[model samples]
Target chain A: MPPKSTKSNQSTGVTSPSGYLLTCDPPMKQFIINLNDKKSADKKFILEDLDATHLLIKGDVRDEITRKVDEWMDENVFSTIERVGENLDTS
Target chain B: MHQNWEQKISSYFSCSQVQNVLVMPAPSKRKRAGDASSTASKVGRSSADSSASSAANTATQAASELTKIDPQEELLSTSKSLFEYLERLPPGTLRSIYNLPPPGGATVAAAVLRSSSLTDIARQCALRLVACGGKFKVGSIVEKWIQRHGQRDALLALRRLESMGILEPLGLANRPGQGNDDIDDEANDSEKRAKLMAKIACLTPEFKGAMKLHLSTMSSSPWPTIAREQIEEFKKSGGGAKSDGGEKESRDPPAPYELELYTQSSWDSVLHFLVGSDEAGKDKGGVEEPPEVMIQFLTRIGLMQEDPDYNGADRSRAPLVITSKGYEFMLRDTNAQVWQFVLQYLNSLAHHNMKDAIRMEALSFLICLGSCRVGEGYFNSVLQSKSARILMKDLARFGLLFVCRVAGKKAFYPTRVAVNLVASNEKEGSRQTDAIGQSVAATRSLEESLSAPVPSRSHLAVVVQTNFQVVAYTTSKLHISTLALFCDVESYRRLPNVIFFHITRDSIRSAFRLGVKADQILRFLHVHAHPMLRNGDHQLVPSNVTDQILLWDRERRRVVMDEVWAHQCRDSSEFAAVGQYASDLDALAWGNAHTNKLYVHFGKSEMVYAYIRKWRTKHYNS
Candidate 1:
């Protein structure tokens, strides 16, 4: 017999925790989780890890989370303008 | 009332010194009036005999009073009587009389009227009327004119003369019960009045004097003289015979079917460029690129725009991308699309400060083309004005005409496209055969054969599956490119006769950004669905795919961010109480007892706060 399926064991609740629900890709969720771990005591932004793509976070820290995500994106992403500049430099 | 006007007209003529001019034609005019009285009796008549006797007496008296008078004085008296007769008529009657159709059913007369300018055809008709002694029965002149030059141009000339007040209708009496009439009766009354007005007409003496002045100043024969001379000069230079290498071939014009093919191909090339098909940019497909001016015009009208990424030294050489307007234009039937281009051309003429005379010539020439028999070659030399010649060439570029040069003599044949340019969209499909005298079934088959290379008609060309797979059964580069507008290129698979692509979320989103609506894409697919799909008892382009496409479009606009206040509670009981209270106020956005938190909508945060304070006081007091 196959091992018991974990699908039935997963929680299926109608009610959700009240917070600012943030939905994003799995990588972005991981990034947010890492950011929450780095925060000092009593300054935790996330209230619950809802799923791989969702996070229930403190409403007061929403602006701070957005700023951090935008900063990370600016550093990680290669924009069209920057790519064009790099190509010009190589040429 | 009928006898009163007749007697007054005779008396007026008898007293005037110009009676000689009227007396010479009195007997003939009396006979004509006698003939008309038979038809006039149908409306209402007490006694035809009495009216005949009265008219006969006036004619005899006018004959007795006949005397040679000065031409100038004669013209003045004639003008006075003409104006007097016109003034005596009711304004409504006068308007209906003007609205009457000319004798030979000139359908193009309405367009000529809108242009509000006289054309060469109208001028020729005026000259013919003047030459025929300045007075003739409306039917005879129109019949004679139609017999010689065809019916299409005759009424345009006649209508223009009437509008200019040079030609006046004489016998249209106001109907008896016109005042208390319903719409249907009024329409019938107008038709009857129009029939009566078609009886007889005469030139006003003021116009005759002007014509005399015009004639005295003219150096050559007023009509066709310049055209004849130009042709003669051209022939003398061996332009007609030697250029085509054979005299016989030079004289024979291309058939209407051939002209249609030529026009269709040229027009397809223009559409191809608008769709940004590879064929339009390359010569491999033998697609003739539309003229540079036309391309510029497309950009100016916002149907196309220079690609922002194409940064070339020559801006004119930059690649063009179609705009939303262009896609909308492509969705319309060919007839409507052509008319739009023609109207835009007319507007551009005004914008460029073209002279009014040249503009009128171009306008009348376009209207004339609408009335021309398809495949019939009109001599280019007939267009004496340089501007008209240039307009003809431009129209040729637009695929409205097929211009062929035989020996240096250019003769432009109006294609079916040009002939139906002014036809309304509803009538275009049915009336196509009327232009070329072909059967409807034959024309449809011929059209399909000619249009094989381009999916111009609403023929079955697309097969869409419930899996979001789209297969277009066309090899035309234009059709393929258009399909790519909202189809995933990464999934594009090409076959000899079919091209397969998928409708992906990203592709549809990009199309939405380009301003194409989800419904338009669905409608496009449905309109071009495969015949097999249509015959089956199933929706074209499965409902699921259409729904998903629409859902994707809505998804882009679905996620709306709004500010809200999160309320934290100490316990589950407190959370339940606050949540219930906020719910009663219809301001609770979210609530969870486990976390003991409640979220209030931002707009109602103050209301919730006051409630929470009141609740706290009551609980603490308890």
Candidate 2:
């Protein structure tokens, strides 16, 4: 089972859309993740699997998680633009 | 080449700094914030938008740098953080969390985290995979969290993770009874996945059951519920062919026996080259020897001393002799042998004060390759920089990596030697010998037709006789050269696969002069003893030979050698003062009170002379 949303609330008050918590108060150190998927959940769906991953970060999870999400999004945009540029050159 | 005694003595104590060397910048200065993101971008962002709050920038900067260097450094620091996290919890919660076994996923998990160039994605992927028990379908991960937006990046991320040992390709053998564990020869990918669907999973090296246990017990938010029925389905139908549950899981395919022979010969030639032995001139059968760059590296590290009479104008005629250090190095285990050179190279960089970040990048890259699957292709990624490419090329020359270049593209593969170099071999006592034994076992199982002529196993071919005679059962040029270190080869026989040699007092003494200790000789003999003579539990060589070798060693060490000068004083009182001064300077070799004479060693004689000359002047002036 994914870490209980209740457990995350009790530990770090930072809340996300699907009960994911990223707190930076105690410094996110290490978290154990379960890579196996739930059978009842839509195995073919997208974004739902993010809730399947448990995150343990150092300090307050709020700040670190926000920064991480923002950085990841930026990477996606940057790579997409670079791919476009490569396509233009190839064509 | 005699020198003046005064000048020689002074020179021995002098300290001089060589000024012509390049110094590298500090690591922190090179760790620029947003460098990872910025490197990928062509159009620059405005300064106002680029300049984030200093704290946030530094945190990201630190994270980026940590990923570049040792990926395990983050795991180590985070584990420490977890320990602290556990300490702050209430007693009841703490007790429950503590009761759960520690997650045994550090090394493999750390490698997965290092797989991605972007820190955030790597972290998320690693966390989820570990929670799911280190096994996930590649398709599941790609479709669920990483599609549509950054699909290419996500795919590349998975490939990188697979190459770095995080996700293993579950071939026919990984399942319960499909593959015969007795055979180690690698099957082609097509042959492995011919009828079955491609299955990939995160696995800890040498430990899968423990990882599963830890994941099952983990109950926390964000850990998805694992379907027991689905897992049972995978476990039952995963393997292609079902048989009697007797086949052992083969972790990795062993390289062909010829590769082992090639690696050994190349390394041994370098050592043989130092001992000034004719074994270096032996047959190569067309395979190339290790490059001259390795010889130069040994010379640079003070392991091999260059010939003083050699001329640089005749570059091809350069000759080098093994120094005392090199002789000692010969007896070290193979891992240690490689490390001695790598450590020396790293130290040379440090000696020049090369930038810590650059040094760390090179060091961590090499270490990371240890876990990478052999024969896998890694396209341009983190190792795209010119320096990184050059370093990889240099390592390839040493036979640590086999670089395959095809039509302007290069894919590097780690050889058995490279994998062995970085294997965290934890078992102590005779493990190197066991490594040799395992190599032989692999060779035996690989080819039976070519077994008689080539000595199937490198480790199983040596036999030690009670009469101080050694017989090595192999045709490997490397084995022959290593045996020549302290033995006289009597004959090379083909039928029974044996090369005979006799150990003598003179040979052992000569080797000792070159700094090969008695213990090292014994260890070599023990580790390389024939599989027949080396009964798993007993001593390898005869006790008489070991005892005689030690006795010969003890005989030589009984005498002391030193350079000293005897000085006569005007009186016993003056002699006492002079002797006291010599003793204080640590130069007094011997003192005779009756004769008013004192002896001083050559190195500290200058200090002794200055002190006595001043004393005499003071006595006369008074």
Candidate 3:
């Protein structure tokens, strides 16, 4: 949902540089994480609109951790990043 | 006279040195027993006590005569000859006059452009002073910024000022601590204490670092009394002392930390002693762990900054800098912050200063730390390469970095405390919706990001939710708890998760406590409503309802602050150092967040003595 990275703006856009990234997924969701930011989306439904709040992570490494948080993942990523719905009982 | 004193012709090293110390990260010359500023102050006071008239005449006549026969041709480097310009002016307009750009223009770049090394920056500043007709005591523009900026950067700025011959030393006249046995043989205890305090108040950057090492090393024991005594002495003597004596005495006694006296525990004390360099708290020296990185993060983010009340900007386009406030909050999430600074520092180290084998090995170990992923697989990588293999073997041997050659990368896991530190901080950083939303109200923007402010708390939790799922991408359990406490935690999942819960009043209320964007909870719920509701046009959550719930969440949120040392010693070397006293080291990291004062624990027993003796014979003299 966010704009892709541009070559000119080193700080902006999607990036996959050489380094370690964390990826965890099972039968439910898939999330790939890099030190800079993340990407995620739901599998079952496609949305017409999702604000910047739902799309990108816009802070430095530390800022992202303390504030400015967002990560894109598979819509069905069963973990917390994908959970939603009415009657979603936590009993 | 000519036979007794040989004139050593000091030549500018087209960037060369005698023993070629690693030019990149070479350290500095500390405060000594008899520096020139101390001598000058002594002369001023003695003259005041005798006849001010005689003293003034003697100095005037001498100064007048020296102008005729000035030997040193030192060219002052600073763009401003403000001190000389204001020699006859009143004090009221002195500040404004000096701060103004010269009619000529700012020549800071031309004054400092040549030498590549920080050493040269220091020396060039010195040479500039010589260039300025041998009077290096020009009013410095760099002073306030150095004292009031991020520690590392402040030191760099300070070092430059010192080079240009402009810094004034704090009255750090050496004296014994309260319990040192040599009290009676020296000056009056109370008088010496006053001197020590005054000295500490105006301490040069290096001695100030010595003071920190002393405090940390003396953490245990009846420290409140000792610290209070020293701090009170400084205050009474008109010293602008930093935060002092609010900490509880460590249950275990403190190890004594003295630069020269307590020859024991010198090894451990030296690392921290370096904290005195203007770079102390802001992370310039080699740090012990990943949390050191968090300090760097706090600086990078808008948390660290000079209070707008303090620094006014100049029209210079150089590296963006963090202010004093940025450095303060940096110590708030102390452990994580320490790591953040250390990581960037290690990265910086990689670019330069890899000359010594030991340093090169240390550099590689740090790079390995940066290069590795956060999860179990990468953490458990095979120990390959002789340097890394040796390092990894030692890490596992000491329980720092674990390995699983068979799984290749899937065998190890940083403990809850370990993984949550700065090494994994950036990973969990993206997941910090709570921190982001909360810090928004508190954080300074852009340049201010490097300077910390009064560490904020009321707004730090904005998006964390129950069931161990953080709103942001972070995997920090502490953040998870920030969210989980109010709501029903569904299950413990290793990774981040998103919940599709019903938009109930209670759920919305709980979400509000996490932070402001929190107003979006109702909307968050609406978008993920039941299948039947999803088909309808009410995709946006109701505004008033969202606002109410967010307000409720704010009402419910509470912050629990951690002391500076609530972190583990995860480095192989430090762990090995700890292995000799594992239980004590672990206690230092966990027990009192402020009590990460390892030297104190070691001081009480054989630990401090042993380490000090070993270090003095090795590090101190070296």
Candidate 4:
């Protein structure tokens, strides 16, 4: 089943709720999940994995997480030129 | 005084002016003769001869009596006498009588007359009349002239010139009333019959003055002389006539269809590059690649974007990918696409700090080209400004003109695409473009290799099955690549005439990631459906397949994220009150009465807070 948005808050009986909005594609969501798993409980940035393409995370770490994603995309996503080169070599 | 009278009397008798007086009896016997002699004295004062005056008076008396006898005869005799009087006038006097002053001052009248540019037919008609001394009977003579010149629409040309004040009607033949009735009755007759009604026309004084100035300026100008010299130099250096006859043979200008093919091939290369077809770079022999400036322009307009994953290692080598906007642009008909490109080019000119006059000239030149005949060639020297000539070259690069050189004479033909540039009717414009496309395709198939495909034939049909299988009946590499964007390529197969592929979940999700919407895909398929499927009663693409595609697209978009302030209330009643206030403010994001929780959108959070404070204070104070 697809992961749905988490409705139940973790802090019971709290008067106010706060979190940061994180939007990314499903693959990026998986990356965030792996990052959460690698970190200690206190250092985990994610408050909730809301759905396939969204996350509820600690507001202070939002910029750091976004920078990491950018770095990852730069390293992992192949440019069109490289892809064309690869196709040429394979053909 | 007696000698002068005798001289005048002898002259009038010798000229036969006193025939009536000679025939009349003595003045005492004829009262009319006495009246004629009295009238003659008044006419003789300018000539200074009494007997001559008496003879002239007798002629007038005879004319009046003849008028009393017969009106037609009176008109005939009066006209004959008038003609004789005119013939006797000296040449200098006649010249002075006909040379009327222009209505307005010469310069102002000339400017006003030349301000409105004439249509081709009207210009030809004006030039013909001016050559014929600017006055002609406007019936069979003008009609025959128009026919001899091979101008079919003589009536339209005449009316146009008449409206422009270049020609004025002197008088109509036949009686004035009868002419008016004929005009009214023959208003709907064929042009030939209507043109038979004789009328006299002359060039207006303003037009004549303007033409004189124009001719004088044209002859005195140094520009045409310089241009002639330049053409001679070009001929000598460019191997026009003095070249070895073997390789430098002069050829006739390209026909309209050939120009269309050239234009389509150039344009197709640009589109293929945008689509990132594998064949784009390989097909350089027949098609010219779009210039670097155009590629940069595409990026600037957000149609294609530089790949974000490039790490700025080599800027020039950076790969540009078609953005979602570019994909959408590809779906538009040729005319709309060309217009968008042209408008964007104009906008880029403004951004590049081009002079206002040059930009306006370019726009007007485009409008003029739009009205030009498709196959006709216009001299390149007609573009007077240096910047306008450069613009002509640029437009040629854009497939809007076919620049040709024959015997050192450079001329440009506006292609079918260029001629239809300013077409206002959307349906007709697309139809014309499609016809050109079909013709180009038909010709290319004859000369191109069997494996090669013509990308200009954009409307080639595609067939889709209920089981997600797709069959596209086209050999175009551009079309295949575009389909590969959203189709499972693992199962893709290509043949000489058709390509086969399958739509899969992973491929669609990847397409969604690229910002392509399911509706755009569905629209593309519907528009390019196979003719067989289009004519059938069933849906173009199976209904279940379309539904599944929509469902797949909807799955990833379920999450809605908004910034909000969450509030946990003490009781359901408190939650209800706060929720109602937030809802009234249209800032309520979500609320659960059972849990006594409510969320207000971030923008209106302070207002909700103020309301809550006011409510608590009121309840506690009361």
Best by DockQ: 4
Candidate 2 per-residue lDDT over residues B1-622, each given as its tens digit: 1223222211111111111011111121123222532321211111111224442243234323433434323222232112121222222332222122233132222332433222455456655776777777655665576666464455445543443334454332221123333222322244533322245556544224333444465442111222345335545664423323554331122245544544554455456555555544334342222233344356555676655666667433345656788777777655556655554344333312233433444444554455554433343333644545555655554556654432122345555666555442322222445455445533443334235555542333556767776767665555566676777543323335556667776677677876788888887776566555534666677788889889878755332334455456878867988888888778876666777766666666667766766776677557
Q: Give per-residue CA lDDT, model 1, range B1-622, as digits (tens).
A: 4344333332322222112222112123334334644322221111111224453344334333333333422332232112222223333333433333221012223333222244566666666777887887666665665567654345545654664555664433232223323422422575754563366667655455445444454332112222345555666776654644554345445665566557656667668778866565353544645533445456645788766677667554455677798987665444555666665454443322232343345545665576556645666777765556666766776678777654355677777767666433224334222232222322543446435775332222677876677878776777787788888886576656667777777788788877888877876776556555545687877888888888877655422233456777766767888898889888876666677877776677667766665675577557
Query: Ignoring the other chain, what TM-score does chain B have in each prediction?
Result: 0.45, 0.46, 0.19, 0.46
TM-score of 4: 0.44
Tens digit of per-residue lDDT, candidate 4, span B543-591 = 9879978987876643334566777776676688888999999988666
Single out the weakest 10-residue window by summed lDDT for candidate 1 chain B: B40-49
Ranking by lDDT: 4, 1, 2, 3
Candidate 3 residue runs with Cα over 4 Å from true position: A1-91, B1-156, B159-368, B371-402, B406-484, B488-550, B553-622
Docking class of 1: incorrect
Best by TM-score: 4
What order do candidates take by DockQ, descending?
4, 1, 3, 2
What's the C-alpha lDDT at position B254 in model 4? 75
lDDT of 2 at B585: 77
Per-model i-RMS in Å? 17.5, 37.9, 21.5, 13.6
Once fitted onto the true fold, the runs of candidate 4 whose alpha carbons sit more than 4 angstroms away are: A1-91, B1-260, B283-288, B302-340, B351-354, B367-386, B405-460, B465-467, B526-548, B566-622
DockQ-based CAPRI category assigned to the predicted complex of candidate 4? incorrect
TM-score of each: 0.42, 0.42, 0.20, 0.44
For candidate 2, the per-residue lDDT at B615 reads 76
**Regions of candidate 2 where Cα sits further than 4 Å from its true position:** A1-91, B1-262, B265-286, B298-332, B343-357, B369-386, B402-453, B456-461, B489-496, B513-520, B531-535, B565-600, B605-622
Interface RMSD of 1: 17.5
